[model samples]
Target: MLQSLVPLLVDGLANAALIFFVAVGLTLVFSVLRILNVAHGSFYSIGAYAAASIGLWIVSSGFSPYLTFPALLLSAALVAALFGPLVERTLVRWTYGKSEAVQILVTFGLFLILEDLQRMVFGVQSLYEDTPMALLGITEIGGIVYLNYQLLLIGLAAVVIIGLRLLIRHTRHGKFLAAVVADREVSQTLGIDTNRVFIMAFALGVFLAALGGALATPTSGVAPGLGAETVVLAFAVAAIGGLGQIEGAAIAAVIVGLARVLAIYYAPALDAVAPYLVMLVVLLIRPYGLFGSVTTRRI
Candidate 1:
């Protein structure tokens, strides 16, 4: 039992890391923009597609395989740079202060459009680019071989969590973000340039989502409906963690990931529903989530 549990734990942590990236981004966007972005998952699929295409090109061109590692980051950066400001400035800006229904509808429409666009561009077939995974090789834990890339993902997730905390607690931009989150009107009154802050926050969220997708591309195949699937799972994580809580999202991701791994190991039929089951139980116990609380919002 100990040997079997060790591998499960390792797999769970790796899965949690990927989920944390997208869930944290979703939570961050909600905390600052006050809008739940229904289209956020499109950025993830776009990043995966971009990274796979770029990585394949690099390999075909006979460039060093090590180049694929940087390509993942570059692909995510490119997606965020292209879509982040454009979508936030034009569409998302319009939804501010609107009803939640209106915001959801508008962003959902964008999600549909982006999904169709991806189909047209990348087609229905899945794209697989696993050079990075192959290059990293494998590691032995409890007599079970696991991808070294998976271990790297676990470490990367830790770095991101710490980095985000430092950015929020210590950096100037983080303070501006905190000010806005505390009171948007008050921040504006203080000449905080709330609009600029919104744009930056939204873009940062996009970068994180894109980075998650780009990193996943080396392990998973990129397909047409991946965005929709990812969005649902991400929403579950965000809800379980509380809509605006970064630390909550991280913890919730671990719970969901462990639930998933356990289900896969013991009862394969329950694998798909395990995360939602955990979410249901958590919500039943704490509707606001483990770290979430009700707060009055300024109109």
Candidate 2:
């Protein structure tokens, strides 16, 4: 039983790491901006494409294989720098205070546009650039061989969670964000630059999404429809965790990851729907999500 459970635990953690990145980003954006960005997944795909392309170029140019690690981070940063501000300033900024339907429709249009752009630029073929994975080698645990890169991902996810918690709880910027989250009008009245905060928060969210995609490229490769699939799963995670809850997102990711791994092991036919099934159960039990609470608006 110990031996069997080891592989399951490893696989689940690895999967959870990727899901946590995107889900956390999604929830963060919603928490601060109060906008559910339908196009957030496009940033993920763009980051994957950039990382794979950069890694491939590095390998073909005879650069040190170790550079691929930095390349993944660079890809994410580049995506955030390039698209995050632009989207937040133009398309996303317009959706503020709008109805949910309008916000969804506008972002969905952006998603379609970005998807087509990716297809045109990168072509429809899937691209694989696993140089980092190759460099990291492999390890054995409980008689099961696992990619060392996978373990690295698990560690990185833990770092991100801790780092985010510290940032939110200890940093001055975190204080500003917390103030804004608690009361946007009060924050604005207190001389906080709400617009700047919104832009920064949105950009950070994009960075997290892109980072997830960049990291995944070393193992999964990038394809045309990857963003769509990722977005759906991310939404399920966000819903299960209760939107806008950071710790909830992390816990939900683990739950979804375990569900997926278990499905793959025991019921292959349920693999794709496992996360959604989990989401269904969670929603039924807690309509506002595990960490979410009901809000009342003044008339």
Listed in order, each prediction's TM-score against the native is 0.98, 0.99
The regions of model 1 sitting more than 4 angstroms off are none
* Candidate 1 residue-wise lDDT, 174-265, digit = tens: 99999999999899999999989999999999999999999999889698988888888999999999999999999999999999999998
lDDT agreement with native, every candidate: 0.93, 0.94
lDDT of 2: 0.94
How far in Å is the alpha carbon of 260 misplaced in model 2?
A: 0.5
> Candidate 2: TM-score?
0.99
Candidate 1 C-alpha RMSD relative to the actual structure: 0.9
